[model samples]
Target: MFDVPLMNRYGLLAAAMSVLLCATAGPARGEEISLQKAVEIAVQNNVELNAFRKEEGLREAAKTKAGLLPNPTLELSLESGALTGNSGENAFSVGVSQEFLLAGKREKRLALAQKELEVYRWQLADRERLLRLDAKARFYQVLLAVRKLKLAEGGIELNRHLYQVAKERLAAGDIPELELNLVQVELARSEGAKTAALEAVLSSRAELSLLLGGSEVDPALPTGPLEAGGAVKEAQGDLFRLALERRPDLKALRAEAEKGSAELSLAQAEGVPNLTAGLGLKRDTTTVEVAGLEGKDTSYTVGITLSMPIPLFDKNQSGVREASVRRDTAGSRLAVAVKRVEREVATAYASLSNAEQLLSLYLRNVMPQLEENLKLTSEAYQLGEVPVLTVFEEQKKYLEVNQGYLEALNQRQQALFKLEAAAATELTGGVH
Candidate 1:
């Protein structure tokens, strides 16, 4: 019989071991990394970004080849035949030939290749920007995990003190054994929560280390305290306009559209005929023996050859249609990209506004009231005016609210990051 619980237990154990291995494999040395350093490391080691850089180099090489003139061809021939009755003749010829692209064909090809190179170059830039955003997101995740672990540890310490006070009261018969049992159970729960939090921190650290392309990581990340006091002013419309102009992905799409236009031009140019011209020098030597008379003659000939393709069967008409279709597709894709960026920016702005409001409410109203309630409940329990259960409930409420507030703060910070990423702007409100 299949056993689901057994499988789940094994899966959990495997996951725990994986986390432990990642945590213990390599230790970070030197000072902790700032956000800038983290972003730099991700850019240098990210596999996708490096692949794009290599692709850009290949496109550049292709562009160079496209701009070069075609190589000339060499022709050689030898012949032996009868020049007269019972006489033999030999001829040898050599010529050099070159084909010239007609009607600015080479120029059009070069232009198309240049546009394609620009597209790849901008694509690489776009990949770098996305990689930086990924790194920043992972960095903040680790920071959040670390913060949560600290909160859990603080809760454990507070619970330990309360357990000790409960033990003293139970020894003096001021509190019943049931109250002491409740404190003990709460301490145990706190310990479990702390353990879970620590596991989360380690997991986040390992993820970040992998993103940095190395195993060594400092789990103790520094996060600046939240600053919510600044006035909440709406971002300018011009800022979003600048982001539309400067965002690398949008630029890459624009370049792609231009390359498609060039492709269309090249396809149209294919209808023009190319010319192949050659200059040739030939030598003919003949010996004639007519019943006792012999003569030798040699002659040189210069000739010009012109070759052009006939537009009878195929004049690349299909290529023109294909190119036109591709251009239209590129145009459509570009429009869709523009719309997506606009929606992304709007969504991020809305999230930031909501997060700011939530953080403010938690900081100014919710947390302070929870703290006061906890204090009052503690005093009442000491004076026997309230049951010990009331005090315990108040403390639990206080801890829950504290955790909620921390979550709200982290959410706001993440929202700010989203806004920056969407707008392609720095935190300083300038275009990145």
Candidate 2:
């Protein structure tokens, strides 16, 4: 008994050690992720996407089941009664029956099921596209927040230096105390803005983490700057064509139309009569005295029976009509889907072109000039050729321009994401 207890204790210790080892090894396996990795994680772990995947699995199973034949049925019967005031008679019967669907009923059902599966397939694809777009948007927002925070920090630094200069000038009787106090006030405000910008960066990072399936991410994550390389030259027609051909929503609508056609076929098939055939055997016995033979027994041979429903009152004409109406409705909906996708593509293309132009203007003309002017103003202040206030105002202008440039870049990235989403293409060369 002591040996058994000792073995149990050692086994427990070994199991505990194994668990500890696994725990220690887990984090090492955690991936050093990029934007594509984050998007993949979101696609895999998002609850809505997972639910849709499960629904697709169920639809596939339904499709498989729909292709199978109907189940055969078994039947039995027994009877007993007194006859001829002498004795009792008994009868027993057993039968097996199966209904054969007419007019391609099984094939129609299978086709409908297959069309439904396609709908769900396209639904999953659409979800993937939307989720990736969302991830890209959030990723760019985080980058923008970081850029703004950096700009705010630079402003704070410049303001602090100006505050110190103002204090020295006041002490040496070169500037009024009120001027120094005003600089100190501006420095404090700059510090506050910097703190707010830092908080915004952290918040944006947290939001990105949630989008990446609740995985923690570094607030200082690096992102590639937006570049305008693939802007559509002839936007309207090409975008419309791409949207009509590749958009998942349009695909889903087309699938619905196919399903509706299948349903109509199935309803028409239902109007045809289905045949049920059965084979049975029966035995009968009777006891009588006055008849030609007393206690007679009889056996009936097995025979086949066929059945079909009469088409007097209802031949499923109404069902076929309803299915026809539904098919028409589905066709109309698909048309609407095509038109909607075309409009969306046109809108996205227009916005993308506008954002690209604005971004180019900021990059080429405004930001470079602002940087040079800020430098000149700083130098002029150092040489006492301009007042300190001029230097401060020019510094503010530089920071503002830089912030605006970052915003324009972010807007361009977002527009690109939307355009790709509309076109159902990968803009980043990989999914994001």
Candidate 3:
């Protein structure tokens, strides 16, 4: 059915072959990239996508088989030799036989193949969407990890200064040794926290590397802010309808159901026996005595043969039943997928809104006041109006609050990805 020109066909083949070979067209190693760039790299270089691109080649092969006719068979025969001779004559025959598919079986097979091709296309698209969404989430996770590490490192610096204050207060006999010792213990905890944060950075970076389809991925951080996405605008639309229209996984399930129906039709068509027929040339030779003289006689004949199976035993009943069951199963799965998408949309919408509200509240009313409180508490401790432990507690609270803001931002972005996955389409002007 394709009307592609020869040059276009070659171009398509080359593109598919490049995907099959996992040829990358991404930024070079050690280059900093945005989340969109990371997803693009993954789509272009992932071996999993390469595997999916090969499915088309397999489907094309099946299509070729389905559209083909049976080959003609040649046969030769010799009969009535001297060993079993009754008339002292030999006969030789040459024949060609052809089997004809009955009940439009070839047409049914082609329909099934076409349906399978449709299903494969949907599946590949679904996989690509899934990979891109996952890459976005993992990319943000790495950013979150880096933000946390920085928070932890800054905590150590803050705690170190507090420890110095406590030490000076101890030397002046304004604080007990026990107070200085407590502050020293908190300083050690912050040190351990920094080390833990460093470890977390390594692991999360590795995971992002894996998502980018390489172990040698750059350690450089992604170039985009975690707070740039998640508008919750899709929630205002008819989300369920949008998911039905756009989700590739849902479309794939629908195509699978169609494929199942086609397969059932193919199975029904396979029940009837095919017609086999042969056409041949035959020859006979004999020697006879006429008027006391030996004479030779030769006869040539044309013969035809035709046959078909009786279908007395198995007539593809098992095949039809299996196909019917599978088709029903596919329909049930499609229904389930639809409902799952609905839940996903609802949940992601709620999460994105919650994250937005949390970040807004933190910025407007919570974070500013908290920072002011931390500054006041530190000054009070330096003036000996508050205990060293109070300053230590305030510093911890400050670190946690800032970390919470970054977490909210990351969560909102991740929620955007989840919504995209649910809709099976990225929000327009939201993310790449």
Candidate 4:
């Protein structure tokens, strides 16, 4: 017979708490990372995010190009009359001209380019926001997997202990062979469960590693509590307000609309034709035949010329219309984005509330009693007051309840992440 102290020593709740507290060290020997470290790594090294960041440089170069002036054109010409037997008669001309932008087109083009750069900057900010959210979610996934693996390990040990107790009872003739066989079956099932849990741990860690831009061959280990996280206490209205003020994508759309307006201004300015003004010096050499000899006479002239398109054929009407339409479309999209963000905040707020309530129920009521239930059942079976099947049922129930509790924790943590993402701000302890 087993001692009651032995029955109480490894109670389910105590084992679960110990596992939750101490099992955060990852299975592998890789570097252990907290949630903050994971997100920082992802932002710094994620290939796609870094690629998106390069677009800012492109936009900056475009802005620089937009602000530059058009280059001047140099013209030269020379003529000889040698083919007509007048080799001494020749002319040479040199000219320089510059095409000047009309109607402030250069300024407008530069404005549009500047607006485009602003839009891209806001978009990059939004991309970073989304990357942070994704990294947090993946970290939570790894935490959930690790917790499950630990729980599964504890289940294996509990089953092994029960199996040994059953063997002792069987040898002393207190229990039948079938009881020992049943305990053996439970032990095998626990081992199989552990295998599955370990697989889940590996898979989740691999995903996190990829997100962090780490090598899959040596994935980083996530170290955090699955149950520990923050929740928002703000009302849905307040959260939606914060989202409107903070969402970078919304700001990007606003900047895009402004850029469209600048585009329209530039298109209108483009309808005005540029003027090319030139200054030239011409030299002419001729032989005079009336002076009884071949005396040479030279003449020099200076002239100015101006030219410009008439704008009678095309006036950039299509370009103007296109820009107007683009502006309107951006405005419409911004309106739609506002509505979408509101919806997202509402949905996330509701989800977080539900998950919090469910987790609270588990923590306050269900999880508190499981240890006593398992301990009492095990002691009763050891004293021969209950059958072996009763102990098995209690143990099975303990595993199921803990699994449910772990799921609750994961759901709650995910709900918090979604809410923070929707609002585009951190909501720790109900404060932004």
Q: List the residue pairs that clash in candidate 2.
A: none
lDDT of 3 by residue, 275-385 (tens): 999999989877777899977678999989999999999889999999999999999999998888888888988887888889899879987798678767865766679
Off by over 4 Å in 4: 1-31, 215-220, 429-432
Off by over 4 Å in 2: 1-33, 82-86, 216-222, 226-236, 290-294, 383-385, 428-432
lDDT of 2 by residue, 342-400 (tens): 77787788788888889789878986787678656754543347887887788777777
* Candidate 1 lowest-lDDT run of ten: 20-29
Residue 202, candidate 1: alpha-carbon lDDT: 82
The prediction achieving the highest lDDT against the true structure is 4
Per-residue lDDT of candidate 4, residues 1-432 (tens digit): 543355453464355445533433333344468777888889898999898888788999999999998999999999888989999999999999999999998899899999999999898889888898899998888877877787788777777767766776777788889999999998999899999999998998888888888663254577667774655668899988999998999999999999999999999998899999999999999988875778789999999999999999889999999999999999999999999999999988888899889989887888778867877777676667899888878878887888788787878888888888889888873322
lDDT of 3 at 182: 90
TM-score between candidate 1 and the true structure: 0.87
The lDDT per prediction is 0.72, 0.73, 0.77, 0.82
Better candidate number, 1 or 4, judged by lDDT: 4
Q: Is candidate 1 or candidate 2 better by lDDT?
A: 2
Q: How well does candidate 3 score on lDDT at residue 246?
A: 83
TM-score of each: 0.87, 0.86, 0.86, 0.92
